[model samples]
Target chain A: MNSASEAQYREQPAKRLRNAAIRRTGSSAFMTLLGKECLELLRSFKLVWVPIVFVVLGIMQPLLSYFMPVLIEKAGNMPEGTVIEMPPPVGSQVLADTLSQFGLMGLLILALAFMGIVSGERNSGASALVLVKPVSHTSYLLSKWVSMMILTWGSLLLGYAAAWYYTWLLIDFVDVGPFMLSYVLFGLWFTFVLTATLLFSTFLRSAAGAAFSSLGVAVLLSMLAGLMPKYMGWSPGALSGLAYQAVTSEVLLPLNSVSWWSIATAVIGIAVLLMGSVVLLKRAPAHD
Target chain B: MTELLQVKGLTKSFGSVHAVKSIDFSIQEGRCVALLGPNGAGKTTTIRMLTGLLAPTSGEVRFHSLARGEDHRSLIGYLPQTPAFHNGMSGMEYVVYSGRLCGLSASDARKRAMELLERVGLASAAKRRVGGYSGGMKQRLGLAQALVHHPKLLVMDEPVSALDPLGRREVLRLLQELKSETTVLFSTHVLHDAEELCDDVVIIRDGEVALQGSLAAIRNEHRRPVIELKLEDAPHAINWAQSFLQKSRTDELRYSWLSEAELQGNRLYMTASHMDVARQGLMEELTEHKVPFSRLEVGYSSLEDLFMKVVSG
Candidate 1:
């Protein structure tokens, strides 16, 4: 044990030690940090709760759509021989509605789950403890971002896949290609917003502040895109609409310039937000 | 001993308020140094800058063994004042996590974590979640994690300030053992802790270095002869004491010999530049005035006195 301690500190050459320290900014340290984050998720049961919530949300849309007519007749006081005419529910359309549900509830869960990802650790002095080592700010922030993305993408897949299965069983059949395309576009939109959450978490000291600010930003952008679709279609806020279109449209793909631009900008925006988080954390890892 | 680290003109400002002001100090290899200061003296800020947890607004922290622009974090381990852990994780897991973050391999990190936990007397509690650990236990766990990589310099900010007396003693004893094996720089408001464990002391006040040197050298340089006079609690004794205070102010020679004097109740405490002169002068004055005295004790001013004066000012 003594030899191990001595060798760890003394045996290594200076140049190699410096290189090892620098190398911590790379993938190896990122993996270690990522593993820790995953462990935290598992221990905290977020891995289970978040996905479960999404699955329930995904299952609700198709079930509610299938039973709406019967429910209306059962609940409403209608006169005898009165016919309540309603259009047939499309499977893809139901799935698109599920995406919209995710845009609200799924987005809310993710924002809250990840709001304290950086700030809590920082305010609690846990980040200060980890950051004093050879680990880099890039590795720290990237690990958090990657873990958040994994949880988000994984939950969305489970939920949307559940919705797709239910829609197929009850409503008209949807195309597999468009279903998967919509999921990716929607995932990109979620990523864009959650990246904003991570950025704000690093910049702000309060977790709630981070959550609300990012959610507000998402709301503002979506409102702008909703209000002026033609002028603001290239914004990341348009990705959710593009996701819905990818599902209901017969084209089986979103090949339009608007969708492409939204996807491109969302990816770029996520990257910039992640980079901004890295810079903020690098500036001050510990908050007083 | 060779220099391990040098901090040159390091300054940190939070808007208009300067937290640490152009502080300069250096640590020699294998020496245990204490950054001694009262609350709000910027000891924590200086330590954070050294550990790379907080970027300095100006100047630089240069490691002797590191090339310019090379990372110095690998050479040092840091423990913050109130070390918070991922409460969901066990003590063992946190240490291993810390070791791995410092670039240790899986096996090495595990082994080092085990050894350090044992060394810090937290081996039995290693499997328990950090949330369950007591303040002292958490501190020991913090120490284990900081030392897992066998860092050349271990910098801790107020390592024992939050602990009770028993906990403080336990940590101070552990630090005593660890100091011989590694270079340690820990900050503390408690002078006794600094005096008991540190080879060198850097006393800071109001974001500035008030005094700093080897403990023995500082003692020798700043030591002053102090005389304490305890008189019987009688009106005549108090009257004589009051008269002595007025005479000392008026008498230039007595004022030069007696640097400072204060009377609290029936006891008079005097700090003097020269022991013999003050002792002789007091004796003659007492005999001539026929002052009623109970006891007279002579000693030198302690570091505690210096600390109080420096910190209060």
Candidate 2:
């Protein structure tokens, strides 16, 4: 036989072996579950719509802020000899305004968007489909966690960049150097909170229940912080507040030890909530 | 035959009430078993336990000879009575996602999804959002999701209850085609569905098996044959027939009035029992009394008859 024919013979066996492996692997089960989740997320106009709205808001907020002074100057409606003194448009101020108004709200909205990720499936009998797959409860929860994390991080980064560009346009000299490291730190904090909220959502049966529960926790903590000065250092709400302050060039106080401790506690809290949701799901009756 | 699903002494209770009570059964490969029961007979609970959705209060459920060993819970496929999916998704997207949940790769899931959708007759609606689907179409879509991964065992809870007559026939036909390759255990309150589709029937009552066996065996065990007479007037004919039947006093024959319907100017009716006894008794009565009837028909007991007997017994 020629060398080409020998090569063909070798390739044929390899191809057959690959087919056999695919059959044995049950890869179809995993794909089916992933496809279902992605499709469900895609179909959820609330989830898809909220992010698009936030991104649009993110882009618009910075551009609007950049042009407001220009528009005011062009109007020339001030009284004669009256000087309208305006503060220079700094990158930090733009970042702070955009992050607080759009970025923070966006993260909160994203968190609320996933409040039904696991619970909705539970209510809709989709969990029955998921459990029967070759996937484990841990992997199921992890998949949602990973997907939400990436989406939240991506949205925040996009907002951050949009605001920076708009600020640069408004002010000829834009300095993003000082706030860059702090923005990254703040993004991590937002991601952590987002993960915690999602974990809470999984534990409840309805989207409303999950959203109320997460928001209730945050609101209660904030109330406690206001009522008692000492409570502010340990509240998870400080993460967003601190990040906002850092970006705005406010007096940067060293995070109290309690704040650091709260971050650790938040991490553990998220893990526990996620694992608890998985266990609850395993025990919940199949909605047949 | 290999036992594909082994459920033994499985039980579940909600506080004071027992939803499923020590249910024991096994499903063999290549067999279609119909779980017959009235409302609240624990059929749903049994399915929940089998699918690992609820932990049994006390009992065992084991899947034998799975491709991935004993822990292969993913090899089973389940269809709920009201299979509520994310309504925002297209049919194709829903089926593919169901495949992925079962461990299929992305490309493979998409490929199999098309084939399953076509099998369930939802190919044209593949790209349409599920929110707009009719009830039958939704049920068909649910079935497509259940079969996307080519599961070894498919457990359906009242799979055809929500369908219209035409849709029911279509789903039943699809299920019949599937029986050649996969094991099917479906629960239904509709006995005709069981009679027309099932090879074996397991009648459950009050959270227990009232009767279970092959369709023929169940009919033979619980059903007694009877005769039906139709007349122009139901009230007058029934009154005359009842009086005549009482006077004839044939101890060897037994029968009862089944149902009656008014059609045009004539009354259509039926009754049921042993064919020979019914025939002889009817002939003697009709000949001696000179009773005139529009039509006389003899029919065998159906699964409905057997089911009523078992559930009522």
- lDDT tens per residue, model 2, A5-97: 999999899879955754554444433445455655655655467657656766676676667777777788767766666776666766777
Total backbone clashes of candidate 2, pairs 3 or more residues apart or in separate chains: 26
Give residue A52's error in model 2 in angstroms: 5.4
Best by lDDT: 1
Which residue runs does candidate 2 get wrong by more than 4 Å?
A: A1-94, A171-178, A226-229, A248-256, A285-288, B66-69, B105-111, B225-302
State residue A153's C-alpha deviation in candidate 2, in Å. Answer: 1.3
Model 2 lDDT tens row, B53-73? 777899888787643234545
Error of 2 at B12 (Å): 1.7
lDDT of 2 at B251: 36
Worst 10 residues of 2 chain A by lDDT: A25-34
Quote the lDDT for A123 in model 2.
74
The DockQ of predicted model 1 stands at: 0.68
lDDT of model 1, residue A88: 88
Model 2 lDDT on a 0 to 1 scale: 0.71
